[model samples]
Target: MYLEKIDAPQDLRGLTTEQLRALADEIREALLRKLSAHGGHIGPNLGMVEATIALHRVFDSPKDKIIYDVSHQSYVHKMLTGRREAFLDPADYDEVSGYTNPQESEHDHFTIGHTSTSVSLACGLAKARDLRGGSENVIAVIGDGSLSGGEAYEGLSNAGEAGTNLIVVVNDNEMSIAENHGGLYANLRELRESDGKAPCNFFRALGLDYLYVKEGNDIEALTAAFRQVKDTPRPVVVHIRTLKGKGYAPAERQKERFHWGMPFDLATGEPKAAGGGEDYCDLTGRFLLERMRTQPELVAITSGTPAVMGFTPERRREAGRQLVDVGIAEEHAVALASGIAKAGGRPVYGVYSTFIQRCYDQLSQDLCINGNPAVIAVFMGTAAGMNDATHLGFFDIPLLANIPNLVYLAPTCAEEYFAMLDWAIRQREHPVAVRVPGAAVVHRPGPFDTEYGELNRYRVERRGREVAILALGSFHALGEETADRLKTEAGIDATLVNPRYITGLDEELLEELLRDHRAVVTLEDGSLDGGFGEKIARRYGPTPMRVLNYGLRKEFADRYDLGELLRANRLTGEQIAEDVLRIVR
Candidate 1:
């Protein structure tokens, strides 16, 4: 009832610690309700309630900018910043995003989704504030996982050199999607054990003031710590030790499992699986584990998402696979894979598609130029509405295509992914990049019967003369459904083709389709600008070929329903069928 009356941060300032504690419980209840209705990042949001309240009480947001790393924890911040109704009402779910967005509220300073970018962005803001003669406190709140990133260290070092007034909060819950890796965890252990009086300090090593708060959730203690560094006038690292799922017993018990997840029972704290299905990432991990056996030279590498891919220590040990988890250092992962390849070892670096962007230079120079035969699997290549613009996989196609001697393949189904993985490991010519789309089925199609670079050949889900639909990756299923709908509803025949490869257009197949088809429709899940569809348009320009490109628009897409995102991009089966009917007639 107290939370219902409060709509802004100012409301919390007037409440006592008891009322604030009660309000925290109410916020948790609202979070659980929304998550139960529609799945979201519940664990991080649940853990940050008291800490967020304490920060907002101590510092004035909007005036004193608080940039959250990854910003998944900003749900609590959103509720306090005049957006409480958005959390309580299910109908107004789209009112605020899952991540921090400046457009949503002034309290959210940056539009962030990617990990380990807060420190760098905050340093820039702090420098700008100094230049403008403003003395507003700039705080960069980063997770323990983000601290492993080389960029964060670079930013911290730069901030120290500049002597800028910046507060860097390291929310250490001892997890990073998977368990934490690297030597820094040992330093964190020392800091925690010594009760903030450790001798060899990592923050001080980078020429910054170091302060550790072991009890992060304690509101009074956190308030005191924030006040102590409010006017420190230099870069400071406040290492706060908090449980990932502090209030909830379920999250506290299974640390990595509850790092970021879907809806769960509030009382029992048991997670209800969003969709009853097998994880494609787990499949890749299993297949790789099997492959590592017999192939003694075969090895695996992940930046920080080993557990997400099901490559836990138990799996790794049983499969006898050599896995090198290089923390959040993506650039190191790429170069390390290249080194492994040079030593006559088959190194397969599997990373989330969005996170691979951090190592573009390393991929081009270190691996591609040296011509090392490495296999890089990019999972969740182009899934709409799953991630914000900062985490979109739209640019992977163009970015990978430009590299010389690099073979790029996009798998539409799970079977093809496994086959591609098999082919990539045996490959000795050059580096191969496989883009795996999200929500792929496990249907085993007939043998591929073609080598790599077969070019934009249609999968031929169905045959028709009036209209031909060209689908890539996961969009092929949509194309097949659209063809079926066209025949049933509109009395139209549609031809569907799945192009496994996105880099080079299959000129031979395109000519064949163009000869008989009245219209050609290209469907992809990435951005339209410089995407696969645009390449097709450039190849066959103005030849009575009506090429309608269906993909993500050139803008920053925030979180929304998956179905809505597909429909908005004209990617749904029904929408494609209707578009084909309009174009054909």
Candidate 2:
């Protein structure tokens, strides 16, 4: 009843402290019920219920701006911002995104999905307000995990000297996507234990005013704290210690598992439909363990996202001395990998396709410029993996492939991926990146070529006449399907080629195709603009050969059906075959 009556923050302003507690309970119950059926960031949402309620109760939304780092924990904020039905009602569950979006509501100022960006974004909002001579409260709600990133430090350092009204609420959940890493966490621990009275404080060192609240989960305490700095001039860091998965016992016990879990049984905490079979994560973890044993100089690095490489807590323990979790600092991870490789140690930085974007500068400058023999394994680099606009892995091509001195390899299958990984580690010539296909792991029917040391070389799976399909990475299987469909439907034996190297075009192979092939079709699982296919199309722009590039359009697609997305982009085998037939005309 209390929750139903609440449509906005104004509704909460009238409620007593006891009624607010009841609302928090109702919100948690709704989260548990809905998340069990349609999985989400359970741990984060559950943990932030009290704090979000307190925030809404204290600040005026659309006037008082609150910026969340990553916005993974913004579900509770959504509930108080006229979007409660999206979480409360199962029918409207699909209406809201997991992250904060300005499109969703005026309450959300930024469409933030990545971590360690809140302080900087908040500073900008505050600066803009200052320039316009407006007097609105600007709050940055960042986590303890976000503090590890280089960007957070930059923002905090800048905010310290902003000399304007800025409030940074450091939500110390003591967890990243994984357990906390780096020396900064030690300082945070000291600060937390000392109740913000730590003589040597990270925030104080950055020249920002500091306050501490030991009871972050207590709504009364949070409200009082927020009110204390409501209209404070100059930036102040309010460090609050809070439990990650507060109310739920299952999530509380296994904080990392509950951090962002699958649809699970709330009672038993077991996934409803468990995924089986070989995945890149588990495969990479095993490979790293074996590789570390063989090569003592081998080092596996992750940027607070060990799950990307299948390095669970158990796997990390097995890795022991070989593993390096550089916290949520992707830039640091890239630079660290470069340093390790330069010093005769083989460093492999495994990160999710989405998170790797944070280190584009470091990737181009620190790693590629030095031409260090470092292996950067990019996971979830496919249209089918991440459907979010901010987290889409489809644009990795434009980000990584365009950079010089980097060999970006696209693996067609598990065997080829392993082979490429091995080669990248052993070779001391250039910095290499492996794009792990999001498609099903295929062993194929034959042995993978051991002579993969040849860079910019493509493997011709099945050679034919007229139309040639140059499928890149995850699209290799689709290319094979299209090739077969062409033979059956159009009575033409089309050529099927797997372009393993993404960074450069196989000029020799393309020239060879022109001899027999009248039209070449390039298939990739990313954007058509500034992508692998566009590069190929440009390569044939001056030639007599016609090149048709098939890929997703340059736009942010949100929560789309995988099959519909393929059809809409003309990426399906039947559609691709039909298009290729027309091009062959």
Give per-model TM-scores: 0.90, 0.98
Superposition error at 228 for model 1 (Å): 1.0
Clashing pairs in 1: 456-506, 459-498
Over the stretch 105-138, how does candidate 2's per-residue lDDT look in tens digits? 9999988888889999999999999999999999
RMSD (Cα, Å) of model 1: 3.0
Residue 410's C-alpha lDDT in candidate 2? 90
> Candidate 1 regions off by >4 Å?
89-94, 274-276, 316-321, 384-389, 442-444, 450-468, 482-496, 511-519, 542-546, 572-585
* Each candidate's clash count: 2, 0
